[model samples]
Target chain A: MSILEILSYIGTFILLINTIIYSISFSFKKEAYSFFCVYLLIMLIITLLTTYYNSQKVNNLFLSHYYFLSQFILLSLFYKYVFENKKNKLLINTTLILIIYFLVLQYAMDTTLFQIFNLTEVVVTSLPLIIYSIIFFYQNLNAKVKFIYINIGVFMYLLCSMLLFASGNLMIELDPLINKIVWIVNASLYIVFQILIFIEWRKNYYRKIPKSS
Target chain B: MEKELLQEDSQIIVIILIAIMILLLMAVALVVFFFFSRKKIIATELEKANLAISYQKELLYSTIETQEEERKRIAQDLHDAISAKLNVVSLSTHVLIDGTLDKEEQAQTLQHILSVTTHTLESSRRLAHNLLPPILENFGLQATVEELCDEFMSSKKVFVSYDINYEDSLSKANELHIFRIIQELLNNAVRHGAAEQITLNIQEYDKKLQILFTDNGRGFDIRSIDKKKGIGLKNIESRVDILNGALSYSSELGKGTTFTINITKT
Candidate 1:
């Protein structure tokens, strides 16, 4: 296989291993572990799709469904982890229904369901994140390094996703160099945010033990 | 398409500005809430502490008053009964020794003086015992408790048993306090409980000591044991508290009464 394929597979394997560890750690009720698992699942799916697309398997509808569905699941899970709520059931169900409705639409579009995919992609990529911005707004005067990290990361992801979507998958016309840069930067921010989420979880978990001893 | 992108960018900027405004308002409100509530909480806690301190002061004052009143009563009793009798005996003895009289009359007078002297001595001994038992001061908790039990048993027909796991070598003050507590409890058992069989046990474990007393008697309603009326029990409780110890009692009518005290020593 090519070097890029080897790197994608290796990344997928690493993410899969992280997913397993996180799934096991979730048994202990660690939010970080669950968040880690969700992120790893997203990354693995993204890498798998990229690998398939490179291998000339772009026409497969199964790959298209797998890609959007994984993103939907990953986004919802990440949203729930950061902001705990019983009321989120409504939000989650609505988002899932929207994804399914669009997944069926992708079949008719015949161009690999890119537009309907964008609908889920844009919202999942932005709205909940902007909802998180509410916290920063409320905490206007407070110093929050984590909030800073999250806001920057979300902004990066939003800019990159928007650029990618606007180009209509025509990388050469939209500047393929910019697409590569956006991809690398967004992925790096995602990895950093994942690490930060894990660190926050560990801090809270350790806090649960009594300090008196 | 360009217009739509520009509109979206403007909307995003507006949303960010709105979010910043909202969070800023929330933070200010939170600080205000904390500032007011902290003072309220502190004020409430201070009020509680003051109230408790006032109640404790009232209790201590009443205890001192009760002790003084008891001392006054004992002093009056001694002067009225024992002292008067002693004066009479002294006059009679003086008359017998100084005046001439028949041998038989003199002998009867001497017998009368001896009986009066004996009764006066008994009354004086009882008075001293009420103040502080001599046996407890001389021999310690075990000997004093045993002597008290024997004395009460002989008079009241109450069977008493004393058991010790380890001999206590405590300070004089501690020994005195423990003795007083035991004495009051025993008196209550005999007077109110009408107890027939009483058992007292002293045991030492680790760095603490325990005193357990059980009586098979016609116990009273434990629920109705008012501190105002049950002065003896209250005194025992206060002593336990002062020692930083624990006291527990359980009793049921016609069943029995059990009192346990656990004291940790330095």
Candidate 2:
């Protein structure tokens, strides 16, 4: 196989492994915070499937659906977990309802309206969700060490996604160096978030010292 | 389809390399952590074992000396009290048997001799039993505890009761240590507390064994007693410490006193 094909396969495999580990961690203790783990696991699985389909050269409407839906799902899951739980039930519920509404709108809007606006509203609205996650990280100081690492990762992801979107909108062909930076950031954020969250979850769950001890 | 997708973006190869590097970092961190923690755990266990061995040696020396001293005291008590009394009664018996006397006078002398002989016998038996209850050496802790309760009940002085709920067979050394602890507590209750009622309980659950002793007595102020009666309490505390157990005391003046020790079976 060519280097590109080999790389695509390796990336897809890593994504699958990350999903499996994330799924296991999410299911281990069934804590309220475990919602984040489940969300990450789902995102990883969808990412894996999309990458595999893209690598296999099945570029079609399904691939586009997979691409947008996974991103939307991931962003929604992230926000819900960051600020949900009993303490912020009102915030959590409103955010969740809005997420579901936007997701349904993406799929159910009139063909003419969709053609006119395309996915512009969906993409634009996601910026605030991502920013809110960063804000939530700042607000939850007890979640500092864990959230700081995640904040750096999510910032990199947001930055790259925005740059890619802006570049696409302008119909500008960016230099290879910019492409390389985006690629590195995207891949590192994916891998780093998986590892960091896994470690944080393990620390919160399995490594607890009993009161007796 | 394949051609169009490949032509679109060829940067994914860089992403793959970056993922591999992150995985490598995590694996390295995990291995280092495992080795570091494993080494520390082993060193800690080693230190603990060494400390326990040294503590055991100190206990052994102290216990042996205490036993020797106890044996000497018993020997002196026998010689001074019971033996001297018995020797005097024996000489009196010989004098009374040899004397030529009338019937009424002979009967009076014989009655006196009989009373003295019986008293000496009773004193010797009581002293021997106090030194080491034969029941304890023969039938183990349970029978001895029951014997103690029976003795208390018969005397009608202290209302003492005992219950044993141990399922596992104890090693001889363990049983002996537990027996001595109970013996000492009872002595303390009788001598100091002026206790009217006392209870001893032994129970085992899961991997733990517990012994509880409670007494209804004119209990002393723990803070005040602790200052003066330090040695007795210290001995109890150290023995429980050696067993890697916990010992707790709850007492109130005019209310009651209770001592409980919980230890691991293994």
Candidate 3:
């Protein structure tokens, strides 16, 4: 297996472990963490499908689009869950508007699913998500909220991935080698993001244990 | 065509390198900003914690000093009031026991011992009453304060006028604290302020007990007075704190002094 494939497997393994841990720890309390678990599960499945399709020599760009779309939707849902109790109408409305915009743009522009990565789609979706993450940071800076760590994780991941995909299509057209390298960096950042989520889950697990006892 | 493609590729590499440099710089700047802000927040929190600790220490010191002063006062009262009179009684009894005198002389000596014993008993009761007045325990804060005012009035030392408008009484523990605070204030006015006339008013307003103590005396500078140096004021302060009350005092040199205290009802 190639180095990229190995890295991909590692990312998949981390996601799988994090999902299982979250499931076991918060099985009965699903409302609080269901969207996050779904995000993790979808990421794991996408990773596995991409790896299998690569080995079988089939075109899997559709899976890549699916990966981005599913992540945008599920991560948005997760954030909505995180801020469910907050009484800020503006933030909720803006998030809803951004999601609608993303869907409309993807449906209108993404005609050929097997074609190159939809750089426009990635940029459009990521910009608002990045803004939302920043809003989350600002809103919770002095608030007595427990989801600060997860918010930071989400913010950093969006920031790095936004920049990575902003220049993605240009690099793909220019040089496959550089494209591969950038994708590797993206994968590493995603793995780090997964680990951050795992840390948040582990914190919740330990926090609940004492209460349960 | 091949040469042109190579040139184009080199230019793209330069651009990518610049982009990567910008991103790296941004990342470094962000990390630095996060750490710097975090350090500032931690420092502010540490300062607040330190301030709270220092205030608590000052309060503890004041409490300890007040206890020591109380012990000294009790010891002095016992020595001067009860102990000295008891000694005189003992000496008289000893003379009676010697049996060197006539019957009339022995009878006179026994009479003298009885008189001394009666005086000593009164002194002991007075001291105990001063320490923790039974009037305060049974009759409540109003009667206790009124009795105290009457005692001062009858003493002809200082003319004290007081008004008690409070209808409800406090818990026993809180009543004791309030009584001590008033006693300390009165003592300070008489001893330190050297006041000839004093007015004390206590009333209940808006779920709070407001106490106003005013004295017309040779008042000293409120700013110049060291709170810790005068155990009387410090004792009052400690009691006010125990009662969860707020106290403020204003004094003008050679004019007068007024102390106001407001305690929230429990």
Candidate 4:
């Protein structure tokens, strides 16, 4: 396999392993992390199905819609729990509603767009998550900031990848070599994101759960 | 349709590249902003904690210094009041034992010994009383304060007008703090202010106690009252701190001084 394909496979496998680990560790507490674990489970399943459809030489671009929408909804709820802001909530809800309405309108007007990466979905979904992470940091300037490592991971990954994802239709029309390079950069950033999550778990969430639990 | 889409593709890619650069720069700027602001906040917190620790250390050092000074004063009193007089009585007894005097001389020596011994005994009793007054232990604060006012009027040559309506009985330890506060203020008025007339009023209402003390002395400026130079003031401040009480004082340079204190019944 080429390095690009190999990197993609590695990211998928790591996501699977991390989801399993988090589910098991967080099952006992059933707190904020329980919702996070559910997000992880959904993400892992979607990644596997997308990889499988790609190997079968079939169209799987439609999966990106589910990926983006589920991610936006679950992670929005997660952040809303972490930091309560009515304004942030309103922004997320309004954006999600607007994007869904626009996408449905586009689908009714034309059906051919489903065969390619929808640029509107990529831009609108990732933008709020980016803004939310920044808001989290801004609100906790003088405090002992919590969930910082995870936030940094999300902020970095989403910010750099948003452009690559948004430009998907344009990228397909360009040199295949450049497209592969973009995927390689994305896979590497995903690895960095996972490493940050691991560090957060080790530093803040490591505990000797009892056997009875 | 295909030619038009192809024509727009390269233009869109160029725009995407520029946009990506802008986003990456924003990300870098944000991280730097959070890092520096967090560092500044944590530094200020550490500074505040250090300031509190140093203040506590200074109060503790002054309290120990006051205790040592009190011990030294009591030791000097023992030497001058009791020790010197005993030396004279010892010398007189030795002269009597030598058997070189006639009956009238022996009688005279005995009388001298009797008077000296009595004076020395009284000095020792007064010294012990100064350490912990029996009047305070048995009669409680009110009776003790009344006697203290009479003693200050007669012995220290200060006219003290004392009025009190306090009714709540406190723990002995707590009462001792109140008594010492009164004693220290009275001593400062007599010795430092050279006050001839002092007025003290202690009133209790709804379990809240207030003490108003004023003296017609050559008062120093209250704004210039330095705790370091006056251990007595530090002692009073620390006592009030222990009792969770509030103390305030005002003075005119040559007119007089007034002190007001308030504390809970507890």
Q: Report chain B TM per candidate.
A: 0.82, 0.64, 0.89, 0.89
> Top model by TM-score, which number?
3
Instruction: Give a tens-digit lDDT track for model 4, residues A146-168.
Output: 57887888898899888888878
DockQ scores of all models, one per candidate: 0.02, 0.02, 0.19, 0.38
* TM-score of model 1 (CA atoms): 0.50
Best model per lDDT: 4
lDDT ranking from best to worst? 4, 3, 1, 2
Candidate 2's docking class is incorrect
Model 2's alpha-carbon lDDT is 0.62
Q: Please provide, for model 2 over B1-266, each residue's C-alpha lDDT reduced to its tens digit, 9 standing for 90 to 100.
A: 85554445444534534554564555345435544655666677788999999867766666676677788988898887778877777776777778877778778767877787788778788788876777767788787777766776687778887888864367766776677677778767877788879998998888898999999987778888765553456567767876778998989998889999999878
| Model 2: how far residue B229 lies from native, Å | 4.0
The candidate, 1 or 3, that scores higher on DockQ is 3
lDDT of 2 at B100: 72
Local accuracy of candidate 3 as per-residue lDDT tens digits, A1-213: 767667777878888898787666555355537877787788888888888987899877778677777777776766676665565435655766776686676667766733767776676666666666666655554334555556666767777777676666677676565456666766786787778787787776656643443
Model 2, position A207: C-alpha lDDT score: 51
TM-score of 2: 0.39
DockQ of model 4, rounded to 2 decimals: 0.38
Alpha-carbon interface RMSD for all candidates, in angstroms: 11.2, 10.5, 3.4, 2.7
Better of 2 and 3 by TM-score: 3
